[model samples]
Target: MSKQKRNTHSPELKAKVALEAVRGLKTANEIAQEFGVHPVQVGQWKKALLADSASLFDKKRGPKPKPEYQSDEKLYGEIGRLKMELDWLKKKSGINLP
Candidate 1:
């Protein structure tokens, strides 16, 4: 028999329950039974909370923001490398421009 998945809670409610489960006020099994959800889901929430707690200590809170990459130095390095390649190509192809 195929099992049906039922998402009975909203995102806000899920987060609330997960946070409550992570807080250890009640066991995951208890929360799962109360919420009519699987214990595995509550366990997953607890695991996620514990794994991510260290990053939450900063001034920023909530979900961690995606890191901003591509520094100016990397851009400059790429430009220089491309310029060198262009110069080499021009010399090899004997291309003269106005």
Candidate 2:
């Protein structure tokens, strides 16, 4: 027999189902049936969801996100290109006059 392909759920859907699972609205088997997936998958999602949620409330949060900056090589390359274009324009148009 051929293998069965399972449908992938989005992060939002997973969170929703996990939240529902946390709320004790229905059994894992029922939720699995509702979402057309297996009970074990829902159980795993619920476990992960709770773990991450608990982390958010934990006192020891990690360091703040670092600011991303442009690389020096890229900036220098852009500056070089601009300077070359300016020089080319100066050669073609002559010096700036009063």
Candidate 3:
């Protein structure tokens, strides 16, 4: 028995077909035939594009906000290391910092 692999279209091709459908320049059946896909597939892609089109403009146009990933324990460890180095330098110089 021979197994047949399913056809997977690239994102670019799907976008092209969906855009054509949205433009009303071609019917779903015509777009599907031209794109070598099923009519149902063309309709699905068009619906998905239309549904998600609003999100394209909904995003803010600026640099993304960075996440605060620093932990309190990590910060405390850095402070402790700096304090130890300062104390060592003071002892070596024979200078008291009270």
Candidate 4:
């Protein structure tokens, strides 16, 4: 048996087929045949388009908000403390670290 090469459809093509499916003017099988894809794919695209349509309008038009966490100064202080403790331990053990 030989495996057939998979077809990669562009986002524009997917949107077109999905829009056709959403119009109810043509069946999934017809849309698939016209677009050279499986009927299942057309159905899936249509479903995703319908489901995500609301998100297009719901999105805010600006940069994303920053996360709330400990400031960089606090983190740097902790790192310095750890380094000092490591240096003290190395000195007591006679372990020279370059």
| Top candidate by TM-score | 4
Single out the weakest 10-residue window by summed lDDT for candidate 2: 64-73
Clashing pairs in 2: none
Flag regions of model 2 displaced more than 4 Å: 1-6, 57-98
Task: Give TM per candidate.
Answer: 0.48, 0.52, 0.62, 0.66
Worst 10 residues of 3 by lDDT: 64-73
Model 4 stretches astray by more than 4 angstroms: 70-98
For model 3, how does the per-residue alpha-carbon lDDT over 1-98 read when each residue is reduced to its tens digit? Answer: 99999999999999999999999988888999998999999999999999999999989988877655656677888999999999999999999888
lDDT of 1 at 29: 84
lDDT of 1 at 57: 80
Error of 3 at 59 (Å): 1.9
Ranking by TM-score: 4, 3, 2, 1
> Local distance difference test, per candidate?
0.80, 0.85, 0.92, 0.92
Q: Candidate 1 on 1-98: residue-level lDDT in tens?
A: 99998776676767777898977899888898888889898887768777877878856657866545656678889999999998889899998843
- Decide which is better by TM-score, 1 or 3: 3
